[model samples]
Target: MKSKIALLLFFALTAFTLLQNRKITGVVTDEYQKPLAGVMVSVPNTMISTTTDSLGRYTIQVPAYALKLTFVLPHLTTQQIDIGKSNTINVTLKTGRINLTEALADHQTVHRKVSGSYVKMESAPQTFMAPMQRYQPGETENYNPINENGFQVASQMPVTTFSVDVDRAAYSNTRRFLNNGQMPPVDAVRIEEMINYFDYDYAGPSGEHPIAVSTEMTDSPWNPGLKLLHIGLQAKTVPTKNLPASNLVFLIDVSGSMSDQNKLPLLKQAFKLLVDQLRPQDKISIVVYAGAAGEILKPTSGSEKMTIKEALDGLEAGGSTAGGAGIELAYKLAKDNFIKNGNNRVILATDGDFNVGISSEGALQRLIEEKRKEGIFLSIMGFGMGNYKDSHIETLADKGNGNYAYIDNIQEARKEFVQEFGGTLFTIAKDVKIQIEFNPRHVQAYRLIGYENRALKNEEFHDDKKDAGEMGSGHTVTALYEIVPTGAKSPYLSKNDALKYQKTDASDIGKTDEMLTLKIRYKKPDEDQSVLFDMPVKNISRPMAACSENLRFASAVAEFGLLLRGSEFKGKASYRDVIARAKTAFGKDEEGYRSEFVQLVKTAETLDNRKETAQKD
Candidate 1:
């Protein structure tokens, strides 16, 4: 009887064990019905876990005692569900706030290609372009070739649609000296005009779309008291649940210039942190450029994390820079293991020192431009101090259709890799361009702050072939424009006798409501053509006192840009104004970026006062 009891007990135990190992399977999606890949599905309170595949399908064995399961992705709000006896649980995740209509409303239209006529004009031969050379608004210029009656008269003025406000802070901060006057010491502080140009944080999708914006018109510097439209764009973060596998190639610059503590050494540590987060399917390749370019390690699976870590550790600073060779080798490796339809990228980490090979800016640019055609994306991580080439790095990133970032420390690496994984790794959209047309009636002359080099010819705004900047996930760019009304007593230039015949009468310009139009153009990551977005600016002015935290913060950033550039339009803008604006705009301060800007302002004040004193002496 005892033996019989033992056999029954054994059977019951075996059946329970089988029940505990039962499998659960389901597909994860977003509200849009798009599959969410790379989402983590795991039992609560245990190391047991599984990740979803590209199709958002997941399968995991659930132990009988497991009462709950959780789905998690970096930067996403985590979700948990109770697991009673269900064999499958389908999950859907909400994306971060990004309202497309709202964001595009305040910017200019972005189109795939400029109108054919505009292209023909831009590409016209030098002989036929004499009249188009210097823009004279509404002038009837005569063509050299005589018609049956006489010289052909044609209106020759560049068609411009948008205007931007210069940053007051940046304009005031610059040190200007009269010609042949005693110049102050050059303040070679490291400043990224572009990166410092805007304020963007990772916010979830707020409305139905991926971008949002609010625009207003304010006083212009050129025209006294005249108001101009100040438009702002707020892009929403895309929800990334299960992203595809990433094949990353790390091209390291170990040149002599990178021997600084903040250069080569910091690079290794930063990359190591990135490696710790890699999954088994992800692959990494290490390429070093010193005396010559060579691959330190072939593409290895992320499962071999230790191997990558060891290779990174073995890297040492020595020899001259062969940036050209390094890039070629890295691109070759990327092409060899091209992961079709996956994230294939070459991340170049350097101090911008390329002295020995492919050092010329033009040569390097050409190489990067050519390689981009192969479907391999590039990303540049700038490091180190003294002799840093911000321009070089910027050009490379721009032409390669990639993003550029400066790494001041390891914490920044986390922000780039772990915190902003989606923005940094995934390309949801590309080639974003903003163009705004100012109504002649609403305001007077305007100037765009910073992007002096990025300014497109009036017609280039619609040309799709012309490359524009790429916005990473959750990245926000802000532009401010000050406008003067027709009757406002601002410092605007009136058409003199030379321009009198070409100029339109002040009465011909439109009113404030019709003063400006915003246009935006962008393409999906895999698309070649861009979509157009347009919005009219006509809202009544809000009390400057009631602007949202985002608006105020953006204003402060604009001011900083003006101060740096030493713009002539810094009238009535004091250091006090910038600081006060920043203080009021400091909301939530999640990353303390605003607070840091405040400190930067203090430093800027000191610099400005010193320069003033030198001028007096």
Candidate 2:
């Protein structure tokens, strides 16, 4: 009886201790009264901390004894406030000076001017930034390894095959890195994405096919002896208001790492923007994972905006990540509430940190692939930095027959969910593959620009079982190839002996004026068999100055990517050359995306110059 009493007392004390913690919430803003995201908020002298979300709001569990809170962010001044007699405290911070000479050193100090002295220095402010907030090159982040495609001899290998990729995450992520005052890793620069980021004024599909194709051939701007071939595909457009009813499951990550401002807070704001764009016929379910997974809201109609907003606003970040469990549960919910013939998808929002269960990328990929066969698609939206898993999320999106985007800010979110609603939520074509057969009589060697991983074997183009990429409504895909005319000497192509087994076939060589044959295969979103179409590209090459704006602009973007990657194949391509060419082709500044590309090039140029100057000093 005495031992039982002691055990009862222990349980009572544990309950009392758990009730001592309180949840505190507030927002952080800048001096201009705008909500400041990515701000670190912490209780001074403790391990408890959190980050402001897209709206600059944060929620942190504080013990009863905590007294003060602190906030910190890059390029922002640090501030602290007392937690006396209140559970909410908002703060506003000013800009901090960044010392170039001291930035690369171990310490950062703010300087001020004195009346009689040239300079007066102050020690760095006590900030709440976690150690994980600092970027360690090749340590905290991940990317797929890229190997640039090499030149192929038309006599030996005449066919080139690859899948069409429409994901613009690479371009946006690259822009984020550049905007943060750093150079992106070479693997992060996908030349195809960079070229396709801007909208092209291609003609719409007018026939039975769901796609319209266009081609242009022009002299290479970077290499004099090579010719550049550009192919563009525009998917059939569907107005956002006319899209089918959607059944979407938001699988969110609220792990400990997501306590950062750019992770959970930004994710919530992005989703809120998406929520505002949904039609009343659409349905949404939200599932969150952290050490465990659970559904926070049932299949709610899009018209219940207030209830959904409340649920989203109440989310708080803590605990480990269980990404796999979250995926399983989300798929289960989506399947249970499946909308036949309508849009059924799972939109995963995360930093790609899976630690507790099924964390291996291969395992997660297999799971997603299995679910995709059930007529449900998956889309991934990456958030935050310093601990991003680019390879993992990209693989999942590819395997699940969905597209991916990286949301760097609220503007990008609006672009994805509002400006390109149909393209973001609807699929127009699947298993889209392209193949080109070069004529040995006119072309000696050729190299495909970018798309190193999407390359496929020639025979796989006709195989129905081979999985390629899917195209969204109103999305445009572009590809470039550099061609070398017969008898032209090039460094990329190595001379090989004539084939001893057989003679080069010139049988249909003089019949047509075709330089190459382009073939495309695609299936309806629900169909298994792909439709075939072919066109012959004539050898009507034009000078760079005489080519269409699309060709010139795309070539300039590719040149910029090559320069950023420090690619060995970049011939005579310079930043100045890219900027000059891009400026000339900035057409129809409706969205200003093309204009932004030019500015990015200029920013990269300035950054390169600063690095050079620092090295010389």
Candidate 3:
């Protein structure tokens, strides 16, 4: 009975924490009456903090449960102010020669009166952020190991099941490496994402279902003996005005590490593009994390564009990252303001650095997994380079049931937030999984191109409770399978011994004109149960040169990825051949994304050649 009482109390306290938040707007200046651009304005002992913007102004969200006191810790001196009922606290610094660390140590001196400084006390949160971490070479970047899928004998393993992946982080990240004239690490190349990053001309759904599937067969580009299977999915498009009302919480990282021009500064420009597309029916809130997570802006109607923009403009980077705590607070806010049957999501813009409380990938994964069940989705947008954590961000995107896009530059940022707004923020279907069953009579062996991390157990395919990928409006997904025909000779094929007690041959399963059967499962955005569907793929193959542009373009991407990773199964693929194939398939170069890809490949080939020349010398 006592334990039950404690549990109830815990729930009550948590409820109180998510209840409300107040905004404090202020400006800081030196004794000379000139505005200070980088002074740290923070609520000591709490996760809430911000630095002065270029204009020497700032706004911070103080949770209703926080203690009323606020302090300004600047480079020159430390000054503490008590919370007295006012929402605005403008500060002016003390003109002194005291060392910053030394002054912070003197409680009496630190609390000395400073003109124009105001404070308010009301609530407090869980933990305080420590000092900033040092960033160095090989500082904080990590990509998880990928054991690429190998060829499977069709008779032994006839079916391949895996969830659909729509993320495009790897493509942009790889571009960053190539632009820097360096080769991306092997594990950094995810061929599935690299392929899906480009837009395909597959027709959209014209049926009752929200997603449509298309398939094609062509001769393998690298190996003449093998066949390439092209599978594509296109989600039905919904007009912007017809889309669901959104309850968006922008969870931004204002940690000191984001002080670089490309980090927090670039994020400001990127989010501007998203904010401009908001409708009056939609709502937005802003939550920032550093030493602690704090709400800088409460839920405001989208009609108030200037108000939203002001809040964004006022945010500045400082303090250590409390990413885990920030995520919890963002989700809490999302739940509190959730729009039933609407788009409720938390968009986290980060460098993926989680240094403070609850920072491990496993812990974050569990947190996101729980939040996803509660109906609020998560979208992670990563920025900056040094200390970027891809493995951690990838886990959150997978478990949180959301898509990811890396904003490497301002242009890529515009492409995502402006050009692909609907697909980035709105979800049409969730838990989308695909299963492909090969006919042993037509195919001897097969290998999936990528998606090493998204493979699912066959039994999990029909399990409604199992989590999968989400598809947004107008989003497209593509996957490739390399097949070794029955009579074709291939070095990649693996043979298995006949079963001792049971039938090993699948020839008795009966032969049909179909090459394989394709099955797709998905749930409506607001649904718990999934709808299953399948289609038969005819056993017909097109010559590589005669295949459609979609097939040819995708093959080029796969070849490039294999070359980048130096995959054992790359066969006789060459960078020059990949480039030539891509040039022929630049269908309708409207956005120029495909053209940019061709140029990127050329740059990579040059880099590869340079390395070879250096090795020979």
Candidate 4:
């Protein structure tokens, strides 16, 4: 009788244990039916939790007795659903208010007008308040410093200098946040990148110069009283078939943090696309780092696609990151297999987490700065999200005289590697610098729309030794400036006392019709000295509606960025304004990139409205 009781007890306990380990699976999305990534789905009051994948799908083992599940994300309302008698639960989260409030707090000088009166935010009620929640250690991604450009007096500071940047990482990263139904952090909104992501219809180079320069002036869309100047640079195009031979090194990060399917798995697929585009004469080498650095494959001809693909397939993620060592090894390989007068580059695909060795941004930046002197350029490809160190990745590329891109999906990989092959790999001009001298005669005050981090001292304009940005084949760069016309009464103008040591020279104030003089300095891919070109732009301003479609579209992107950043300078700019401007400018968008922009605007508008309603509720 005792033995029988023990057997029955064991069977009962076994059944109970099995019942407690039931599996639950589901998908999470916004009301618009778009798959949301990074949504935290978890069993209430338990440690069992998981994040939705890129496809918004998740599976977790939960106790059958679990009563409820919770979904949470930054800027979105917390949602709880009862789990009674259900094996699967599909959830849609609504927008919440806390995010914009925090964003506003970050800008110490920011203020918004309410009821025709400007109230100091420090004393204002917490209109967008919410319960504070603690965040996980690796939840936040690093980004470069962002300070909106302010007005500068042309007379006090005549020369505006900056590097030419073409990196489009900020655009895709912003898209990721919005697609997940969250507004992107202000630092993630780089207006320059957002505008440059789309190709414009600027004229190509027509002469011996490696890049062509174009300029246009129009009435500002955001502030009708201000004048907007558009400056453009189009690099000479080199057909892929006629491009020079190539030597490339693939540096991959397989850190423990990269174990997610979206990290390592997506990385492999991206590299395969590049492999498919390689030529017989091009060479490829693979180097991977995880707790240590090592060469995974010898430098092989690109014609051996199968071999490369196999090597990529064999990669697995584990251990901590040793990004510094990996970079050193990749650069060494590129140097060993250096192809003179050919495209030699080290392409690093990582989340930019360097935990083990030389992980500090300063150390890593110095290393890249040193290696770039060898004429082997570097290009950074960012992947993954959690614990992503964007600030470090951007530093590596900027100091190494290379470009940076973030790959969020396979389609982006195709856009970068296949469609823009020549522009991605082949550099046409290096150390490209732009310095615009506004005529104190025709301009009173001016401010650049973006390129805050790329600004340089006026003296650095002519310094060939100073590093700037690079231009790839067929690449186009656009910059906008808002100017307060001479004698226009505006709050942005600086109020300065008359100089005690200097006297005013007004002889040439209104003699010429020149609005500004644009000076460009650039070096041939392999040259050390830079060639200079100067062009004076006349004050031939046109109405916003009468400007080229390119100007209109670029302005719309800038407006969208300002809204996302919550800039104090965003005067009367709304999502509706952006949609209207973009609709008129969506011309010859064969690739549908412009159309996509319109959709993004609509989504943002809807999300904004949801947040407002949530606040009211």
Candidate 5:
């Protein structure tokens, strides 16, 4: 009788165990119904996880009590679905086009991503967001300091000059922080980059010039007492087929520090996406550095996509970082296979950790400066976090006459590699500079919103030898200015004593009805001399509500940046106002980036409030 009882007990427990365990499978794809590789599927609060393969298929085991499964990828909106009684779930993930507020505003309940972007009920239980985790022990990240620009007297400084920067790395980096439930470092917020991250409906170049300039003016939203000026430049878009292509080298970092899941694994997937978009006319070479640098793949046509992807897949993380050696090898390959007047560029994907030979910032700068003069440009794509050397990577891009972008997720990679393919690799114009002369007659003082690092001297504007920012094909650049109209009262405009040498009074005050004169200088990709475009901005002011989507949206971004930086010039700026303004200005945001910006703003507001409340406690 005792033996029989023991057997029965064992059998009962076995049946219960089987009932508690279940297997779930799913396929994930993007909005366009394309398979999305590298999507992470996992059971929240557990170590059990699996990733979608090249075909977007994933399988994971879960406990019967597991009510929800979370899907996370930096490139797409996060999703948490209740397992319920289903054995298979087909997930459709959307990018910025999805409304993130539906989840946050409706408590813990979230909506699934669909082609039409319609909201539907989800099975997940209500839960709070995860806590923030910034850095690990002994981890250090670097960023250059930014000194805010204060109001300048139009009489003393009537003209402001700066290079047109199209790099949007700062905005994406900031989004990473907000998504992690933390406020980004103050220095990380570049107002200009944040504004330029979204595309505006600016007119493209039509006539002789390869670029177009447009302007908008309205009363400042943050400070109703001041006037705001918005300037934009749009480069003519070139289709992929029409773009020149040849001699492309990919310099990859397979160092020990890049062993993180977000580093190497994400990188492989990102590069695969880029490979899919390549043309047969273009050729790619692979150079990897880890302790020492070597060529993995010789110059091969883009038609051999599998060979290139396999080479990227075989890369492993180990040994010390030999960034300098890798750069030398890649540049050598580029120069050897140099295609005259064709696109010859090196795309370097790394975390900017260069501890090996030729690692110093000065050395890197000098190296890139030399390589740039050889008619070879560099594109630095930053990956991973914690120990990310942004200051170092940005220097290389600025000096090499290239561009920099931080890829925090696979979608960001798709953004630079697939979406902005032509612009990412081909340069339409170089040495692009913008000079704005504020009419002292109509303006008293003016302040530039950002571009502290790209400021140029008055003489540099006309100097052809002076290197400035480069404009990629189909790229758009925007700038903002806050000026106190003549006779307007403000504390920023300090009264200076009468000048002794030159006349302090405004000489061009009544010269024209123009509030400012805009002058842009750019050079053809192969030309040394620059072509100039000049126009005068009329003195016009409209209410913030009546302004164009371009102006309103840009102003809202500028305000959000000021709040992030805790600027003294914020002047009555509030999260509520920013949200309202942005909501109204999200005109035809096809990609939904504008919607994502609003979500980030809300997240920032929450984080800021939490900090304030904790301090009070």
Candidate 6:
């Protein structure tokens, strides 16, 4: 009787202890009622911490002594609540920004001022969210909240951010060639400009608000010499609550040319990783083409991971590429399983070798053009190395009203899929174009670096029907301008007194607000008509030595791109300068991107020096 009583007492104590340690479960969100994924929820004084999942839901066990729990996200105001008998706690994180003006004013003693041949200036009151806020591992924040009707509603405005750098020297060289009535060097082509020419990121109305642009400017080279201007813009992302079910068709190429380890195999791994993020409501279909096209699997829910894995594993490289047929069948399947108001997309993975039917470029272009009208979006993922058809893939993407990405490895795949889920998958705005008019008084000669193919005739700026690129959610696009001061003597343009169109005595022309005007055109996600926005340029000239941080970083990136392309305009640029400029502009070292850039410069230097030595030999 004594032993039984002791066992019963032990059981009672255990049950009480278990009850005391019970977990709290709830969802975390932002002010917009969107799920806030990857938010860290933890007991403030303890080592216990858990992150919210894709649904922004988290379950964390806490000790009885724990008084409260805190939820935190980088660049967001942290939230904390007292722990109670209730087993659930929902949290909402408020977005925060870092103001450059505040930092500068708070630490005026640390700021160094210097003057050189050209004046330099720091960034103005710049406001930006931390990189972690933009891209955090495992972060999944909903863009919209579910409505009372049980259907997900869309936000009114969709926004995105984009950043790219163009080599100034290369741009100038291309312009010089154009002025001299000659074809520019093939390497002078700016891919970023081409990519940005069309908006690929913007998705339409979630029914919340119109998109707004917050722009910041900084000096270039991040050094005393202001050689560039860094421009950054942020747009609010479109919100999607309980988004309609999606039907995705993966059109893969298992051709002989794609037998490289980084080709077919890499494609498989990338797709597998994406599959992990798929929701139960999402359906995936796999189609493979070599000598001919064939459906490997019908549409299946994401829950059937094993079945999808099996299909991907069985794929083998054998015959010639039949890209046309493959695309046709994939579109057919997508049309059959069309989800009303949901994302219907065909993701084509290939090395872009189309050797079989409809191999003619025009024919392939027409095929995609016709299908684009059906509301199914296309995205081209290029893989492999040698003989990769960048041109062909680029054309197909352009015609199909889609985007193209070059996946070098698994990391890039993650950057595209996991890190930028919204931008990669959803379209908020389309046919976005930018046109800048420069005043002859403020700038003698200005060159737009990069974006050779994206350049439109001045009249095309107002043409709404003309197709442009789409901007995705949370993506940033940046452009730079290098202007020669009005009084500056032209280095390449010679004095031609005999020219009939020559005009003299125009030296009094000065800078004016009309010196430059920036015009942007974009269409709402579901609408065909476009809206225009314009900003006039002002005579805000600072010494080149006092360029802002944004300017410095952008200049460095552009210089690096020029060096990589080996353009003739890379006159005085050195890799060392690029590294120095980037390091200077790297304020917080948040994601180590600046550091990585320095390393890439070292690599470029080694490669360039080797080439120089080989040429001498």
Best by TM-score: 5
Give the per-residue lDDT digits (tens) of candidate 2, residues 81-151.
88888878889876553322232232222222233111223332222223223355666788899988888
lDDT of 6: 0.59
For residues 474-583, what per-residue lDDT tens digits would candidate 3 score against the true structure? 99999999999976888776556866775446566575888899999999988899999999999998787888898999999999999999999998999999999999
Candidate 4 residues lying further than 4 Å off, grouped into runs, are 1-138, 500-510
Which sections of candidate 2 miss by over 4 Å? 1-139, 505-508, 614-617
Preferred candidate (TM-score higher): 3 or 5: 5
Give per-residue CA lDDT, model 1, range 345-384, as digits (tens).
8999986767787778898887887777666788888775
Number of residue pairs clashing in candidate 4, backbone atoms closer than 3 angstroms, sequence gap of 3 or more or interchain: 0
Candidate 3 versus the native: TM-score?
0.78
Alpha-carbon runs more than 4 Å astray in model 6:
1-229, 238-245, 494-511, 543-548, 587-592
| Model 3 score (lDDT) | 0.81
lDDT of 1 at 546: 66
Tens digit of per-residue lDDT, candidate 6, span 1-617: 99999999999998787557668999987666767655667775444566665567888888787788877653345677998889989887765422222322212221122221111124312111111111222432111111111100001001111222111122322222222223333553353432232222233333332334323333333222222333444345644344456789999998787765557756776787678777888999999998899999999998898899889978877688898899999999999999877778899999787889779989888777777667788888877544566667766776666666766544445545666666676666666777655555554545455555455665665676566676666555666654444455534334434225433223533434554556667776667787877676565756444755655666777777666555554557779988887787766543333554565466557656776898999
Question: How do the predictions measure up, each by TM-score?
Answer: 0.66, 0.79, 0.78, 0.78, 0.86, 0.64
Order of the predicted models by TM-score, top scorer first:
5, 2, 4, 3, 1, 6
**TM-score, structure 5 vs. true:** 0.86
lDDT of 5 by residue, 471-501 (tens): 8889989999998997799977777775577
Candidate achieving higher TM-score, 1 or 6: 1
Count of backbone collisions within predicted model 6: 58
Indicate the TM-score of model 6.
0.64
Q: Once superposed on the true structure, which residue ranges of model 1 sit more than 4 Å away at CA?
A: 1-213, 219-228, 492-512, 614-617
lDDT score at residue 542, model 3, on the 0-100 scale: 75
| Poorest lDDT segment (10 consecutive residues) of candidate 3 | 109-118
Mind sharing the TM-score for model 2?
0.79
- Report backbone clashes per prediction: 70, 1, 14, 0, 1, 58
